[model samples]
Target: MMQPDTLTVFYDGGCPLCRREIATYRALKPQGVRWINVADARPAAGGGTGSACPLDRAALLARFHVQRPDGRMVSGARAFILLWHRVPRFRWLGRVAGTPPLPALLEGGYRLFLRLRPWIVRRAVRDKRAAPPG
Candidate 1:
């Protein structure tokens, strides 16, 4: 469980794109945001590297997620909103995006991104393991 002031973010560390984005957020060093990479084996679900509300590994890897201080788990575009809400520069954007019907529109776009995420990850990483075996 998170402290009243903290928000826990769950991400896939193995993903190059995810790593880069998380690094960017880490650079900002926003207060009360705890980032966890779910790529670790046997991730804890009660806080720290593990999430307060754990999801299946596959599900965690498939989308972005965040657990609020109250232990509610949110994901995809909504998760991004919670994150942006913490960052000073992006706070307005988060609030605006979170407004009525905007989340729904963003979710539609997020679902489309999910469909192409494999391709995007492959292109971003360009690692041998991510490449097609021949």
Candidate 2:
């Protein structure tokens, strides 16, 4: 509800699942928003708040992050909702995500997602390990 300039989304690019979801988001959405794949979310000088991409990759991979036009940063479900709202079709999903119960639901879902993420990461790592040296 604050300013509407640029939006920065912090996601773990190493995770194929996360990348897939981001790809879907990018596919449907236009150029209105800027997606930032950060390795970390910790505040940095002109980082996060700034409209930069591929910054602080280490922090972003740790968790989900979103920086609003108000220069405020939110993580987890809140961040997801912010990006969802930007999509024309998913506006309602974003609104629902903001609701008290929905945020809770989203948190629960995120927990489950986390449970599965490690398996995904391990498998991905294993695949890379198995690949012949090139």
Q: Pairs clashing in candidate 1?
A: none
The TM-scores of all predictions, comma-separated, are: 0.82, 0.70
Per-residue lDDT of model 1, residues 25-63, tens digit only: 888887899877888847555433443455777778889
Q: For candidate 2, write residues 32-100 as lDDT tens digits.
A: 577765533345675542434334545566678887776677777888898989876788999988999
State in Å the error of residue 112, model 2: 3.3
> Which parts of model 1 have CA positions greater than 4 angstroms off?
41-51, 127-134
lDDT (CA) for every model shown?
0.83, 0.73
- What TM-score does structure 1 among the candidates reach? 0.82
The true-versus-predicted C-alpha distance at residue 35 of model 1, in Å, is 0.9
